[model samples]
Target: MVSFGDSKFVKKVCGITQASYQHGWDERNGGNVSLRLTAEDLVGFDDVSEVKRTLDLGFDAKVLSGSYFLVTATGRYFRNVISQPGLDLGLVKITDDGQHADLLWGYEDGAKPTSEFPSHLMSHIKRLKVDPEQRVVMHCHPTNVIALSFTHELDERSITRLLWKMQAESLVVFPEGVGIIPYMTPGTNEIGKATSDKMSEFRTVIWPHHGIFGTGDDLDEAFGLIETVEKAAAIYSQICAQGGEIRQEITDEQLGDLAHAFGVVASPKFLS
Candidate 1:
């Protein structure tokens, strides 16, 4: 059997995490990613059922029972993930009772999954309720997004509209708009709960003064959601840095047209 280190899932994690790090988004272990896995995805691995270790989850995740995930390790640097995936990434299966996890592969040096694992699982539970295909949760501290949270209003409508106005792709990419929750402590169940609650309505959630949470059917999709938001926020920041005089911008009507052109439904909450 091939080593988990060489698996495509691990390679994807390596590529995306490295890319996120290089984008100046996740600096010094500031980001984490988790991808849900199906039994089919684990089929070829020898000892797939072997538990290298068992971990306490510290919270009930009954909805996640029997599920498997590939996750970044806590305290592992995204910059180093590409070069040391075996130690920086791990494969785990939620215990049947959902109170613990069985480490199936990777985390070769004995490190545990990210402290944000609870948040990721919480996001998965809520998002899967709305989107059965949802499989990935990515959290990162993008400089631009965080900066916007400080300068822009915290309401979802305000943030979503500004982002939509900054780039036409913003409206097309997330026509349903984004959600924003008040700043909360990271890596805690409370923050996870808030994020997942918002995930029930939106694919993206901004944690004010902290970072952003994005969900998708796959890693690329999830990463793209966050990347798009950051791009819009970056443009906004650039405008603000240049003395912030808006000669003109993408109007709400234009955003509506963009949505219609792209066959997406603009969220009434933000667009109307």
Candidate 2:
């Protein structure tokens, strides 16, 4: 059995958390990541059956019963993850009933999973129903995306169209567009449910005045989705700062052409 410290999963989590911190997306303990792990991914780790401890999920998650996830720990700083992964991350297996999880590795400091664990699980459950391959859910307070929530209209259609117009790659990266949820207390079942409901239709969801939730088939895909959207938001913020006036921007027809060229469908509602 390979040592947990040398496992590829541990290395991936460390790298991502550190990179996120470097990008300024995760400050202090502000962001969290959860990756669904398959049985195959546990091959190098020893003693899968051993449970270091059990944690109550606070809510039923029977839909994800028996699944394993690698998640960041609560109150742990992303900047510290690379240097002390075992203390900042954990490997947990959802109980057969899903009301609890068993720690299989990591979490060396006896820390619990992220406070948003339910939110992550909620997203994973919904995303899996739509895209069975979905494996990662990432949440962070991206400056521009959060700023736009305050200045721009919260109407999903308008925000989606605005973001699509901000960058040519925006439409291609998230053709279904983004989902917007009115301000709701984070880390609660209500917000988790709202975010999950949105995930049924869109891969990205903006928590008005807070941050964004992005899901994908892997960590990179999920992180890239958030990064692309945040970049567009940053461009929009810059334009607004220069002068909240738009002399020219990507038109609907051009968006259509770009989508066609990319062989991807832009959101019909936004396009119209």
Candidate 3:
């Protein structure tokens, strides 16, 4: 069970998750997203049998506690996200202890959360140490982003450098820049480590042969950043495919100047 200090926040998360799902950005079962609300909400299980099964499946017991996590239910459809375009998605509240997880309202029966819950829960605990206020953490497999990720051999630092040239504010706005985690088998603790590490630096990460994960001050901003980075990557890929090279690479100084000019930090070079 997860507890929320604010019910409205939970509804907001549900709505955004649903909208992103509908946008064709979140392929079914391809990724998972979560938001951190309480930082210390209790983890929920169907019963003791579930807990034993989780442990038998090799999950740590410590991961069962967090403030509150908005997870995608196992093998569930994104279209059926708890909330719709203009609906209040509903709330599931659990206490600080794993006593109960109750869906306040707005969700129909048979709707389960995403299987990526453990990864989301673990990532939150790690990222909060860097930015305590970040709320929404999203994972998606946009075609262009994945395409770019697959075509190259990139370390997290290199990708951030690339994004910085293409958009600088994104490089440093959320503190650090983009991170690229090595591919991992999904729904495993191995991926959790990579996710946590990436979230600490930038708002987004591109998973090779996988997808991308993003976090933000809110859901809208987070999703927007994800879209922006994907667009940039798509354009870059198109240029490369055409046998054209990046026309110009801006210096850090110019990037800083652009950031100041925009009233926000962004990469210096654009489609000019």
Candidate 4:
């Protein structure tokens, strides 16, 4: 429950993530999104009224804590998704002493914390800077993206290259590089490593047959890149299935520009 910055933008991003989540794309109970927001407490419940205000403005507060909330909840079937009005949600708020965040309340049905809660917490407090003003993380399992990770015959490196070519923005934003972690059981320590290791080099990481974990300064930008990556993968899957080669690819220089636009970290020398 380390305190991080907050943002109204996160609420906006959560709204978008919820739409994608409930639409049968990320899979019911398969994807997760965590957003950091301005800290109201070193560790305390976020003003529930303010949370309500954000929701009134059409933000989704799935795992609302004090200053942070997860966009998705745990335990509910994706079909019976608790995505509507007046739904109860639980969150862990950081206490004022800068010690820890405690569980505040339960959403309708008294939902418990998500199994990926540790990952969410770590992403916010431990791994990367999960401040609201700085980062929004969305993790999902789009079918095509997950499908690419399950195969034995496909060249992993080549898969990303082809997908990036399909959407030039990916090549730039993720230009430092994308990574593939060997499969690990969902919500396990191993999976956390899979996520943590790639945090520095790439903003998004794919979990084979599982889902995607993405982060960014803004929520839409982060999630949008993921959608692009997913769409590109979908196209590549279709083309490769037809036994045809990808028709075009962006040069490394073009990728550099894309990364710069996204505010991705670059080596000191590259800055000059």
Best by TM-score: 1
**Among all windows of ten consecutive residues in candidate 3, which has the lowest summed lDDT?**
48-57
TM-score for all models, in order of appearance? 0.98, 0.97, 0.72, 0.70
Per-residue lDDT of 231 in model 1: 99
TM-score leaderboard ranking? 1, 2, 3, 4
Please give, for residues 162-223, the per-residue lDDT of candidate 4 as tens digits.
56566766565555445567678877655775576666556677777777777777777777
RMSD to the true structure for each prediction, in A, is 0.9, 1.1, 6.6, 7.9
Which ranges in model 3 have alpha carbons more than 4 Å from their true place?
1-15, 38-66, 82-90, 93-107, 167-175, 260-272
TM-score, prediction 1: 0.98
Model 1 clash tally? 0
Where does model 4 exceed 4 Å of error? 1-14, 40-67, 77-88, 95-100, 126-133, 152-157, 247-272
Tens digits of per-residue lDDT for model 1, 83-164: 9988999999999888999999889898999999999999999999998999999999999999988887788888888999
If the candidates were sorted by their lDDT against the true structure, best first, what order would they fall in? Answer: 1, 2, 3, 4
Which candidate do you rate higher for TM-score, 1 or 3?
1
Error of 4 at 219 (Å): 2.3
lDDT agreement with native, every candidate: 0.91, 0.91, 0.58, 0.55
- For model 1, name the residue pairs that clash: none
